[model samples]
Target: MLLLLIPGVGLAIAVGILFGWRWVFAPILGWAMLTWLLGSLRALGKDAKPPGAPADDVVATPVGTDQRTLFWCEECGTEVLLLVRGTNRAPSHCGQRMHERTEILN
Candidate 1:
């Protein structure tokens, strides 16, 4: 889709030069800018939330020695062993925060 912009710009330049219609570039450039802005917004939205994942506001507290806590990512089968962290925020993977799973080792 971005490759199409090159031809659009070239065509705009050609029209402006041949017919002295300089105003044609305005709409073309505006379209390009709008496309870029929308694309960036979509990227941010995707990075903000992954499918079937809860919000990031939930904080996980540290567990005892007998209990183990795992931060798991649903998007990609990734597991992280959270141990002795000062922060309450959960670990993140694949742009989203991992879900917490507690297990008893005893």
Candidate 2:
């Protein structure tokens, strides 16, 4: 991803050199509009969502009253101990659902 920024920075520099800071908004606006147009077109595509797209939105294992579990994020090691039961939805962290750990650690 960092490599992707090199071309963007080069373009910005070229635009700044040729048009000056006062005209920088023109290229920025054009780039934004182009990105938006491409995004809109992608949204209209027939295969915009492949077969497993719905699975991404599916919640993890359901939480229940008898389950004394800790919702743990493997990404950042963030833990949330379920104290009171509410919705069965498992807590999410770092853009992914946390795993359930039934064994309470000391």
Candidate number achieving the greatest TM-score relative to the actual structure: 1
**Compared with the true structure, what per-residue lDDT tens digits does model 2 show for residues 1-106?**
9999999788778988997965677767898999999998886784345665543443344455354678899999999987754555677799887887886334
The candidate maximizing lDDT is 1
How many angstroms is residue 87 displaced in model 1 relative to the true structure, after the best TM-score fit? 1.4
The Cα local distance difference test for each model comes to 0.78, 0.73
TM-score of each: 0.41, 0.35
Tens digits of lDDT, candidate 1, 1-106: 8999999878878988888775796776898999999999998896465778765454454555678888899999899987655456677899888898888888
By summed lDDT, which 10 consecutive residues of candidate 2 come out lowest?
Answer: 54-63
Number of backbone collisions per candidate: 0, 0
Please list the residue runs of candidate 2 whose C-alpha ends up more than 4 Å from where it truly belongs after superposition.
1-67, 104-106
What TM-score does candidate 1 reach? 0.41
TM-score of 2: 0.35
